[model samples]
Target: MLNMQLANKYAKAIFEVAQDDGKIDEYGTDLKTVASEIDAHKELASFLVNPQIQPNAKKDLCAKLFKEELSVSVYNFLMLLIDKRREVLLQEIVREYQTLSNAAQNIIHAEVTVASALNEKQQAKLIEKLEESTGKKVVVRTKIDQSIIGGVVVKIGDRLIDGSIVRQMQSLQKQLMAN
Candidate 1:
């Protein structure tokens, strides 16, 4: 709960900074990069969050790791968190920041995976359906996933709409076995 409060504070700060610099898109990409970096390095994440590690050391390490990737404002903001003993909240902060950033800009990202690549007309139609369903501007990223066998799997935020033939076959097999 307290982490959420802190995250909101930091996220708002970042959003404002990005807006002022006209780097909202770049900042969004930067945040995702930072999050991915932390995700890829589990030991580093653990070390950063460990209470036994001195806060100053953590701050230095963070700065060193992200010096090239982060802007001065972002670096100072992260240092501020370290000074406040809130360095452990990076994951929550990143998550909340992304949520707020997306909402602020009315940006939504979705992905559609199908057994084969959709033709241009099919892509447009699928995007139209998503817009009708979501009632928002839909930016659909398309991908080909042959493992799907057939049909499509759509993901919007955390929700998944699976219309895949593989899943349908499994479901059908289950019902038949019960009979």
Candidate 2:
């Protein structure tokens, strides 16, 4: 919980900077790139988060790796995290920043689970339906869950719309038992 709070705090600070510069999406993309690199290279991630490693060394390495890739503000933000010994929260901070960015852009992410993969047309239709229902732009991430048996389950934030065969069967069973 404390870590999340810290991440949110850091994310909000950088988000505001991005907002002021009118580069919210660009900053988000830069953060994502840095985070993705760290996540993809486990050894590099360990080096950055290792308390035994000196902050100067981490900052130098990061500068060499990202100085050309990231904007000045974002590169400085990375250095700030190293100075504060909060580099460990890089991923969480990036996630929180993305959440803020998405909300600001009036976009919502949805997780759609189905018994099998939806083809292009089916996926588009589902996205259209979700957008129509929510009145917000929808970004869909699809997952295949065989246990669903059939049908779809859509999750958006706190809400879950379960139209899966398993759920329907369970509902029918409950009704029959109540009779």
Candidate 3:
């Protein structure tokens, strides 16, 4: 809980800075890159969070690795995390920043699970329908789940619309059992 709060604070600060500089998108990309790199390399991630490593060395390593791709402010932010021993929260911070960015841009991300992959026309139609319903710029990410049997399930934030054949069958079975 404390970690999430701290991550939100740091993410908000950097997000504001990026917004002011008209570089929010760039910073988002950079933060994602850093998070992805750390996530992809277990040794580097372990090193960042390891209490055995000295703070200065960790900061130095971060600077050396990210200097080329990250902006100065972001680089300094990473160093600050090292100094504060919050380097382990980098991924959370990046996720928070993305949330902030999306809100600022009035963008909504929806995950659509379908029994089969949608073609270009179907994907576009789904996105358009979602946008019309939500009144926001909707970004649809799709996944194929054969277990759904047919139809689609859409999840946005805390709300879920389940139109899958499996779910329908289960609902019908429950009603018949209750009867």
What does candidate 2 score on TM?
0.91
| Cα-based TM-score, every candidate | 0.70, 0.91, 0.90
Q: Candidate 3's error at 19, in angstroms? A: 1.0
- Compared with the true structure, the alpha-carbon lDDT of candidate 2 equals 0.97
Model 3 residue 58 lDDT score: 89
Between prediction 2 and prediction 3, which has the larger TM-score? 2
Q: Weakest 10 consecutive residues, lDDT, candidate 2?
A: 71-80
Candidate 1 segments whose C-alpha is farther than 4 A from its true place = 111-117, 132-135, 141-179
Count of clashing pairs, candidate 2: 0
Q: Find the candidate with the highest lDDT and give its number.
A: 2
Task: Residues 11-111, candidate 1: write the lDDT tens digits.
Answer: 88888998898887777777777778878999988887788889889877888898788877777777887788877777787887778777777767789
- Indicate the worst ten consecutive residues by lDDT in candidate 3: 56-65
> What's the CA RMSD for each of the models?
4.5, 1.7, 2.1
Q: Which stretches of candidate 2 lie over 4 Å from their true place?
A: none
Instruction: Sort every candidate by TM-score, greatest first.
Output: 2, 3, 1
Answer with 2 or 3, whichever has the higher lDDT.
2
Q: After superposition, how far is residue 49 of candidate 1 from its true place, in Å?
A: 0.5
Task: Give the per-residue lDDT of model 3 (tens digit) for 51-109.
Answer: 99999888788888998889898888888889989899999999999999999999999
Per-residue lDDT value at 91 in model 3: 93
lDDT value for model 3: 0.94
